[model samples]
Structures are given as structure tokens and as C-alpha cells.
Target: MSQEPDRLFAQPLAQVADFVFNEDVARVFPDMIKRSVPGYPTIVENISVLAARFAQPHTTLYDLGCSLGAVTQALRRHVRADGCRVIAVDNSAAMVERCSEYLHSQDSMFQELLPVEVIEADILALAFQPTSLVALNFTLQFIAIERRPELLARIRQALLPGGALILSEKLRFEDAIEDELLTALHLDFKRANGYSELEIAQKRSAIEKVMLPDSLQTHRQRLLDAGFSQVLPWFQCLNFASLIALP
Candidate 1:
């Protein structure tokens, strides 16, 4: 319930990243994302905008890669208390397990008041019900580039005719100079937050195999190809953007 680090930061690294996750790396993720990405708040702000667009009396919301359910919890406030149910999905068993435990441990008053369900599932091979609001927040880039279209298509089919999907991602800039500038800023932020230059470099090297960032143009094209009627980026902050697409 508390938003500060004292409460949110207390999560163990194993729990945050799941068992294979590095605690130190997990501990610094929040700071790293904030520093590495500009317009991060836009991602938060767009949540309200997206909510208003598709809001219903009791919507069934799906939060893909609900990392520790941080954003998931934030969106709960916007939904009317009795009508919304968040089905949080994540692949990391460790993170899901810990999140479930934490949710259970929440004060009884809060428990009696909110409706949230956290589960472990692969987004790429998921089954969505007819009525659902799907969100892929800063998680789509991690999926293999070739698999994104198929995944999006599946999500589109799962939604009702008027269902909405909100997607946010870290994009690749077109200009080499811009890329370098953003990279430098991100690296500096990491260093300022306690990661050494060497450590940051090593981490980047390790994830290079899996991190795939597409340009904004490429992303919009993909959404259209996936059968979205309107793919509009309502918010853009540097390389980070929040996209709203309709099926």
C-alpha cells in the first residue's frame, strides 16, 4: 500500500527476478529504468488515459509481465472498487510466487477492499477471454522480434470488438548520434545509482542477445498488421512510448 522504497524496496532480489534473477540487478532495476528511459512518467500518466477510453462497470484487465505488480497496483485506483478484476500474468515463477504471497500478506482491510489475481503464464502462448483489457507495459521488447506479430494477433482475437490494448516499449532510435546520446545518459544514470561503468557494460553485454528494440514506425506498422484499427501513440518520452491500439 505504501509507495515509498522502505516498503516496495524491501522485496528480496530472488523474489523480484524470480530464482534465476540477480538480487543486486533486481534491486537496481527501478532506478535503472527511470534513469535509462525518458518520459517514464508518461507511461504512468497514459494509464489514466487508457483507462478512461475502455473503462466499464467491471472490466477484466490483463497485465502482461506484471513485474511485482507495481503498475498493476497503480491502475487499481482508477478502476471502480467493485467492478474491476486484474489478472496479472508473468512468466517468472519466482516473481509471481512472491507477488502472490505479498498480496496475501497485505492488510486485511486492503484485502477486503481490492480485487487482484496474480498468475504465472507465458504471454506469447496465452488464451484471452472475450472481454478483457490487455496491457503489455515495457515488456514487449523482451519478446523475440519474430514472435511479436503472432502474439499481438492472438491478443487481438481474444478481445471483444471494442476491447483496448495499451502497450509501452523502449524503442530504438533511427539516428546513430541520438542512440549514442541516449545510451550515454542511461549509462551515466546507472553509474550514479551505484553501478560501476564496467558492471553496466557487462550487464548490457549479457542482455544484448535478448533485448530487441524496434523503432516507433516499426511498432505502429506491427500493430496495424496485427489487425488493430487505430494504433496511436498518446505519449512519447525519448525512446519510451505508450501506445493505445483498438481491435
Candidate 2:
């Protein structure tokens, strides 16, 4: 994994374009995500713990939008189910190439890690196999809002009995006051993580156009409508949250 710092947004731009997960972003993703998202480490660690509890024998697990294979690595480290394998998918060719290298490195250091396949394909167009656990860690917000429900429905339909979907997302509050406070707090968090004002503002300009967030109520309702029997929120920090949707 590259240890380069995130400075993509440090310089001023005439027009901050919508963010894309290209080679430049892939190069600094580890540092960028760690500093930008609060409680990211904890969320990644716990995804494995949650996987161990729900992973069914002889079933496949999926890590959608698996940038650099962090969730896939965690699942391989902790999941001990018989005949289980992991399939990590990402749309960014750069991310997929780098992720494959990182997982290959993990293969050398670890013994008997679960078999994994990394593919570069748009997840919305990809076909899912029967899976026990599906992780969408901070990935759903990047999808077009109109297509999200259909995607979730497809995931729900592919899930085997006793399967689970772990979804982590940035949230938008319905209340004006709550939304303003949390948004301020998130900016403060970025400052505390060493991002300068220019970097923060530039990053925000780049992301706001592409990353569309929904309220918790909207998420729960959509999950239920997508055929999930129950939607359980398990973690929250400031304006971000993770949910477990069971079939």
C-alpha cells in the first residue's frame, strides 16, 4: 500500500470537477480515506467481526467498490467459514490493479487466507453470485440515487438465507439545525485530521456534485422496500453511519 499523503485538493483549481477514483486518487486513497472519514478504521475492523458472525458455510462473500481491498483483507483475516471465498469488485481500473497487488502481498505473509478474485467492473452491471455477506462500505453514496433501490434489490435477491448486507454511508439530516451542526462538526474533524482550509473547501467542492447522501429514515425505508426483513443500525459517528440489513 502506498504511504503517500493526500494532496490532491491542496492546490486551487479554476473549476473543481466532480471527484473520480482515478490513478491519482488511487495512489493516495489510503491516506485520503483515513483522514477524510471519521471512524473509518473502526468501521473497517468491525466489518470483519460482523462477517464472522454472519458468514455461511460454502457461500461467497462480496466486497463491492473494494478500493485497495481493505474490507476484503479484513474478511480474509477473520472469516473462518468452510468453503468460503471472497469476490472484490471495483469500477476503477487503477484501484483494481492496485488492490490485486495488495491482496497478493497479503497472500505471501498469511497462510490459508480465503481465496479472492478482484475484478474491474461496474458493480451496477455486475452479476452477483449467491453470497452470505455483502459489504458496501461507503460505496452506495457514489451511485446515482434513482438506481440505488434497484441495486439493493438485486443484492437482496442474490443473498442466501441467513445472509446480511453491511452498508456504510455519509448521511444527510432532515432537520436544518441538525444538518448544519453535523456538517460543521465534520469540517472540524477534517481540520483535526490535518487538512487545511483550502484542501477542505476544494475537496468539498469536488465531492458535493457526485456524492449524494440520504437521511437515515430514507435508507431504512429503501432497504425494507428492497426486500430486507430488518435494517439495524450498528455504528454512527458524527454524520456517518453503518447499517446491517438482514434477509
Candidate 3:
């Protein structure tokens, strides 16, 4: 409800640093993500709907890399399974602090909703409980490429039978022409959302070193390698895509 417009990259920068989720980013994340990620609203909203379908009674729902608690709130809003609790985790202290505040706001406005626990910790370091739903929305791409397989395997191991892990990411294409087209279209999407040329250039430079996307085929295969029986892609807007992997 209290989303500040992103102006972090509005000014000219002599050298853009790799992006980090700090207090400044926590303040403007809602605006930045919505404007930057195409169909982000649809993905988050439908994540909740899909979460409702996968949520099992008495199981915990995990929202990994839950910056500002967007997916966390969605899961709380739609999940009706009995005794279900939401655990939102982020490595950034600033993000977890604000996410807790936002979830508290949602709590005041709702009734009999699932309880939420906001944890400030790295997802890979923490021990997981059997979870019914795990939302990894745009979080995995920031992780080190070499460590992704173990991370997915960990998620798969933690998931209960009939549970799922919903992963949303900016995708990369192996095809040269397809990659070029989608990249241009994504830049246009940012332009349409009011990001200026300077802002776009600066932001892209900042995230390029940190955010590394994989191809859709790689994602599906990775999920299978992690022991998930199915990797169902439910949404794809421009270069962004969301997949539901079942264990």
C-alpha cells in the first residue's frame, strides 16, 4: 500500500554498481518490480490462486526472497487450507523489516488468514520444514549459477507430496533472433512504464552482473534433475516466465 516510485537510477552515474537490496531498494521495490518485470502483477496474483490449489492442510508455505512480501501476502489471502502458515524469508535485513510491516498491514485488513513469519536469512543456509507451497519469484536468478542445482534439490526435498514450488524468472533464449526480439520488447515495456533512457541504461547495467537468467529448457531439466516430476510453465510475458514444479 505504501509503494514509493523508483528514482534510484534517474540521475546520471559515472559508474553503476551491481544492485543490492538495501534500505533504498526496500523502499522502492514495489514500484521498481512492477515497472520493470512485464506481467508481474498477473504472476503474483495468479501465484496466490495457484498456491490455493496446492496448499495442503497443516503444511507451511515458504516465500523465498520475499522482498516487501508481495507473494507472501498473496499466499495468505488465497490459501484456505487448515493450519497453514506462511514463512517469508529474505537475506536483506531491510527487506525483511519492511516485509514484516507490510504483512502486518495485510493482517489488520483480513480475518482468519494464515499466520506469517518473516525471517531475515539466506535461503540456502536455512533448514527447511515440509512445505506445501514455495514461491521463488525472481529470486533464483540472483543466486550463484554454480549453486543452483543444489538449491533446487533442497527445495524438492523439502516439498511434501502433492506440494509445489512456483518459480518465476526473467528467461534467456538460446536462439539469437528470439533473444534479440525479447530483449528489445522488454526494454520497450520499461519505456512504456515511464522509465527513461538513462534510468533504463543505468538499471540494466546495475543488474546485469547480479541477475543471471537461464533458458526455459534448462529450468525444466533442472527441475527434473532435482526430482520434480513435472515443470509446468503457467505464465510467460516477454522474457519473464513462471513455472510450477511438482514433487
> Which predicted model would earn the best lDDT?
2
Clashing residue pairs found in predicted model 1: 58-83
Model 3: worst 10 consecutive residues (lDDT sum): 1-10
Worst 10 residues of 1 by lDDT: 1-10
lDDT of 1 by residue, 72-137 (tens): 665665655347677888887766765676566653435443478887888887777654578888
lDDT (C-alpha) at residue 222 in model 1: 92
Question: TM-score, each model?
Answer: 0.80, 0.99, 0.99
Model 3: per-residue Cα lDDT over 1-247, one tens digit each? 5568999999999999999999999889889999999999999999999998899999999999999999999898889999999999999999988888888888889898789999999998979999989999999999999889999999999999989999999999999999999999999999999999999999989999999999999999999998999999999999999999999
- Quote the positional error of residue 45 for candidate 1 in Å: 5.2
Superposed by TM-score, candidate 3 places the C-alpha of residue 158 at a distance from the truth, in angstroms, of 0.9
**Where in model 3 is the C-alpha error above 4 Å?**
none
Cα lDDT of candidate 1 equals: 0.69
